[model samples]
Target: MIQKAQEFMNENHFADVSRVQCLLRKMMSKEYHGLIDQIKEYQDPHAIFNIHGGNNLIAPTASQAEQKLVEKPADEIKKDKE
Candidate 1:
């Protein structure tokens, strides 16, 4: 779950950016959709880079996506837009 992942990262001193990679691997797994159903609660679901929304999971809405974009470095944001 997301909390477990955060705990792993904290215990290992991993940066926040690493969460994106960590969740991406989990999201890509064969059990991803099933896992969504089991995840009754979660936080920052948008942090998963390429989410596949099952019946339970919800992908970032447009405004949320834009907010994430604003958090990036200016140059990176420009490159993304390009």
Candidate 2:
């Protein structure tokens, strides 16, 4: 399970903190079981959000639309995409 989480993190950039939490919930259970806290503490917030054009391929800061998207339910976002 840890391996799966690592892979998912590798593929997906942590732009929205809530999105990361949502993933942890889906991947594990109701709670991330300390995973979210660990990431926040260990990882650099700027790097996670890819604020600078570093070699690491992380996501950029969340735009206004993205902020709103995060506020919406996952189901609603999926529906909008469809």
Q: Over the stretch 37-57, how does candidate 2's per-residue lDDT look in tens digits?
A: 344312323323322234333
Query: What TM-score would every model get versus the actual structure?
Result: 0.25, 0.28
lDDT of 1 by residue, 3-45 (tens): 4553344344335544445564567666454433322222233
- Superposed on all Cα atoms, the candidates' RMSDs to the truth, in angstroms, are 10.4, 12.0
Which ranges of candidate 2 are over 4 A from the true structure? Answer: 1-14, 30-32, 41-82
Superposition TM-score, candidate 2 onto the true structure: 0.28
The CA lDDT of each predicted structure is 0.43, 0.45
Angstrom error of the Cα, residue 54, model 2: value is: 38
Which candidate wins on TM-score? 2
Worst 10 residues of 1 by lDDT: 35-44
